[model samples]
Target: MDFCIVDWGAISSIAAALIASFTAIYIYFQWRNQKGAEVIANEAKQNIQDILEIIKIVSLIRQKSSALERSRNFIDFNRLYESVVRSSLYIDDCVEIKDFKKAIDEFFNCCLKFKEFESLYRDYAQDSKFIAHVDSEINLIQIRGFNIVNTLIPYSIYQKKFKFRKK
Candidate 1:
């Protein structure tokens, strides 16, 4: 009778190699997923920054409009209107920003109407009704800006909290 001997050492080495390959593959996939997540987070942060810049432009328009109201000068009014129209192009694509844009449109339309009446009576154009309408539109813009900023706060907090973990 012939007896065959099993090579236990060879079997153990093969098993070890298989386990190491699997671990390496798993780690590679996990790293790829983490990189994807980081890219998404960075994009979100950039969007927030863009929204903020739009808000600043809107605020500038509001300030200029208010000044034009007080000064009752056509030059300032034209400048303010031009600024609002120009800044609208920079507004980010978001729900709150859309609302702000709507308010700006309404305000611009109101200004046009006011201009029509200004030729008849300058004082009447600056009446309480006109002031109130402008005030409401400005308030709406402010509210929308605040809401957009509020939405970004959580992302900022998350980034700050998790930034160290990536390192």
Candidate 2:
């Protein structure tokens, strides 16, 4: 009877140890999963915010371009071209969504320079050649911007396949 009791005690101790170990492992994994999820959520939020900001800047560029056409001075045209080229370089260097955001931010800075120039230049009417030059530059900027957007769309789709969202 004493031997049976000792055996029962041994079994109970082993079972309790197993349960505790399993619980610890489970808790560790659960915490890891939660941390992963939070990281993804934060990334998503930042990415979405970046995209929205880029969209806003693009919209502003379009609006400003329209008004800029009336300005005979081509001062903003050179700046716009520089910005577009810089943005193209940025896009070429990008490998991920966050890189994309950085590229877009660079592009936004360029657009803002163009915007600033436009605000200053649009106050006057000067020469037909200047107006024409500005118009041409705007066209080029539009084409390049569209290309960047097109290139990014596929990447964003591919990114969706990854568990960018932590579950």
Candidate 3:
């Protein structure tokens, strides 16, 4: 009688190698996905913080009750402009965001109007009538800042963007 032999030891070793390879691939992909999620979360958090800071700066600028305080607004305005420009990159400027960028551009115009009006209001501090007229213009510009910040800081818009991207 003749007997045939099977290489059980080699077969088991090959099976072990295949299992390890598959496990390594699975772990790598899972790690990559988790890292991607961490990055997205950090971006969203940064954006929200920036939006709130912008709104707070606008409020501080608006709350100036004296010509001297408002006159010094250029410093705060500069900070606001820099913050907005820097945050724009982090603001999720994807095509799906629609005219969110247009609103951001509108801030430049709003800040310019505030700066000009405040300067006028401050320059004619000695004249009563000119101060009155300057006050009207400055008040209007402040209101514009208020409106713009309202639109920019809404959580619903950011939430929608975040949720859409999370998918």
Clashing pairs in 2: none
Candidate 2 stretches greater than 4 Å from native: 1-6, 65-167
User: Looking at candidate 1, what is the lDDT of residue 15?
Assistant: 94
Model 1 collision count: 0
Candidate 2 per-residue lDDT, tens place, 34-66, comes to 665454444434444443444444444444546
Sorted by TM-score, highest first, which candidate order results? 3, 1, 2
The model with the greatest TM-score is 3
Per-candidate TM-scores read 0.47, 0.41, 0.51
Provide the global lDDT of candidate 1 against the true structure. 0.50
Clashing pairs in 1: none
- Give the TM-score comparing model 2 with the true structure, all chains together: 0.41
Q: Please give the distance, in angstroms, between residue 101's alpha carbon in candidate 2 and its true position after superposition.
A: 14
Taking all chains together, the TM-score of candidate 1 against the true structure is: 0.47
Against the true structure, what is every candidate's RMSD?
9.4, 8.7, 6.2
Candidate 3 ranges with C-alpha deviation above 4 Å:
1-6, 67-77, 80-84, 87-167
